[model samples]
Target: MKRFHVHVVVPKLDESVRFYSSMFGANPTVLKDDYAKWMLEDPRVNFAISARGGEAGVNHLGFQVDSEEELTALREQVVAGSVEIQDQPGAQCCYAASDKYWTQDPAGVPWETYHTLGDIPLFGADSHEKTVAGASSACCAPAVSIPAVVQRKVGCG
Candidate 1:
């Protein structure tokens, strides 16, 4: 089953964890000093929060697939919609190694489509890559400029 993934950039991890825990009515499935995740069965969502650099709101949203095949299909879907996608074959982000495709919504919010390969000990890769938003993205979010034509078709331009 594919899970809906929502990553929120939080100002305070401990405070957000407490609020979400109460809202979900369960403790986080995984909790770290600066990150927390709730793998909720009822909602079938992978909800995560981190004290990462960015606005304190939705960092990105993604679909968490169970296999690479599913991830490929998602990439194709984005392409078919005329949106350009940036591929990350083995990206270590959000404490997981994943094969992912990154793209932006018409409104320019980052969206990820990925299959988790395994877990890692860190939030993201060590060396920072220049991101679309400048500096580095919180969770290996790819930095790509969508073509003007593509953006126009999607009403972003």
Candidate 2:
């Protein structure tokens, strides 16, 4: 099984948590001082929000896979589609260790495909401080410049 993932940066963590909780009709499965996550079974989504002081909007979207095989399958699909991808074999982010690949959509929205390994104490194992938008240094995929030809074919430009 794969769970759709959405991470958002918020200005007010507590208020956003409260609003999301009310809207989802449930409390967060994991709540930290600055972060909250709701693992919803009904929708099969891993929705998270944090007040790290960055922009108050969507940070990234992802698919959370249950196994390495599923992750590999997704990577194959991305490759077949000729999309630019960055592979993080063992990444520690959002308090979980995962093997992930990162890419951007035509509109430049970042997307992640990962298989969670386990949980960790810190948001990320990297040394970089949180960004003004409240996202960790490893929160999103590093930007990759798309080739003009590919961009044109995809109507990106």
Candidate 3:
């Protein structure tokens, strides 16, 4: 099984939490100082919001798979279609460890497909690591472009 995922960056955590909770008719399943997540069964979506001081609006969209096999199948589909992707295996982000593949849609919206492995105490375990291009890694999302070497290593175009 897979759940549709949507992450948004907000300016105010408390206000956004209040608004979303009222709209969803339930409180978030996971709430932190700067983040909140609602695992909504009604819409079968994993909707999350954060106040991380970034640009406000949709942060990213994704599919959260239940198992590694499902993740692999999704990855294979992306590869078969020859889409450019950034693969992050054993990534710890959004308070969870996951294996993820990221790609941009035709309109340039970023999308992620991942399988969660477990929870983590931090928002992102490797938040400080520099990418192959020497740019600081974004906490929950990949940079716009991955280095060719990394793309080759991940077997993604």
Candidate 4:
């Protein structure tokens, strides 16, 4: 089965990890000083965090497979194109699962290829885990706050 992958670079790896852990109900399966990741199965996605160049958010995104057989097939396909396999499957990781691999597109963006036979618990989309509150900042500030009553009056009720 085909699945989506998204990698985001963040300023604070720990905050991002906590944010996603609360949002997705799964902690990073793999984490290090420079990187951390969540292999979430319910929605079939791989979320990656990286600390490089001081940049933050969405490094790349692609597909994640479901089995070793699937990974092998994709590895062959990737190798045939003369692309070196960055990370092979079966490598030890931190949180839920045990193995994963990494690949890259022609543009040099990284895409994670992995399978989590051991599933992790997931949260609903509307879970309080997510930070919907936009923070005040220089580049972008939060919009005017409205009371629940005003929200209801505006048909957002």
Candidate 5:
């Protein structure tokens, strides 16, 4: 079965962690200096927080698979279906050990599937820093532009 979770960005990692710990009545299972995540097993949801750009709120949310084999098979299925696979399996990312595949629907909403294997690389305190930076550098493209519009009064051009 696929596991679903949301990743929330936070301005203050420590503050968020403390608040969540109190609200949930349990400490986060995975805690790093720059990142913290609470695996609420009872509810089967993962709430994660990271201190990056001092921005708070949802990052990217999706399902977590159970094994590498599952992830690899999913990737193959996605590819065989001819739906573009955004990220192929075998890429190290997000402080999680596993293979993953990212796919987007026709409406442009993204979905991800992966299986966690073991500990993830710190990449210097903030794991997202390295991962996000590499993405921007390698996968990023120029933003598309839109034409500006001008409004006129009834009598004014």
Candidate 6:
């Protein structure tokens, strides 16, 4: 199964967390000082919020696949569609490490499709990502021209 993903950049983390928790009727599955995530089965969405700069609105939308086969199929479809893609293997972000594909939709909205590999302690895209060519994404947000996000901490390898 593939879960829909939506990441929003907020002006205030706690405030947004409060609001969304009220709306969703549950606490976040993952919560940090500047980030929170709700892996909700009701809507089957991986909804996340972070106070990591950018304007207060939707950061990016995506799909979180369950297996490597699904991800490979997705990548094949993207490649066949002629959409430009930035591939990140072992990417650290959103308090988790993932294999991600970054691209934009027809309206140019940034979209990420990834398969989470494991969790990380922090919320920043670490220096290890810099090793991947063209992998300049920050923590919890797409590197594409989605919006102006705050610079990530350096050397968090």
Best by the TM-score measure: 3
Best by lDDT: 3
Candidate 2 segments whose C-alpha is farther than 4 A from its true place: 128-136, 141-149, 152-157
Clashes of each: 0, 6, 0, 3, 1, 0
Candidate 2 lDDT over residue span 1-157, tens digit each: 9999999999999899889999999999999998899999998999999887667799889999999999999999888777777677777778888888777787877788899899999876745433323344545544343221144344556
What are the lDDT scores of the predictions, listed in order?
0.80, 0.79, 0.84, 0.54, 0.59, 0.81
lDDT of 5 by residue, 10-60 (tens): 888889989999988899888887777888877787777777553366655
Q: Give residue 95's error in model 5 in angstroms.
A: 2.4
Using all chains and alpha carbons, the TM-scores for the candidates as numbered come to 0.86, 0.85, 0.87, 0.46, 0.66, 0.85
Q: What is the C-alpha local distance difference test score of candidate 4?
A: 0.54
Tens digits of lDDT, candidate 1, 77-120:
77887787766677788788888877787687778788989899
- The residue ranges of model 6 lying beyond 4 angstroms of the native Cα positions read 128-135, 144-157
Report the alpha-carbon TM-score of model 5 versus the true structure. Answer: 0.66
List the lowest-lDDT window of 10 residues for candidate 6. Answer: 143-152
Model 5 bad stretches (over 4 Å): 72-83, 105-109, 123-157
The true-versus-predicted C-alpha distance at residue 8 of model 2, in Å, is: 0.5
Order candidates by TM-score, high to low: 3, 1, 2, 6, 5, 4
Model 3 steric clash pairs: none
Answer with 2 or 6, whichever has the higher TM-score.
2
Shift of residue 9 alpha carbon in model 3, Å: 0.2
Clashes of 4: 3
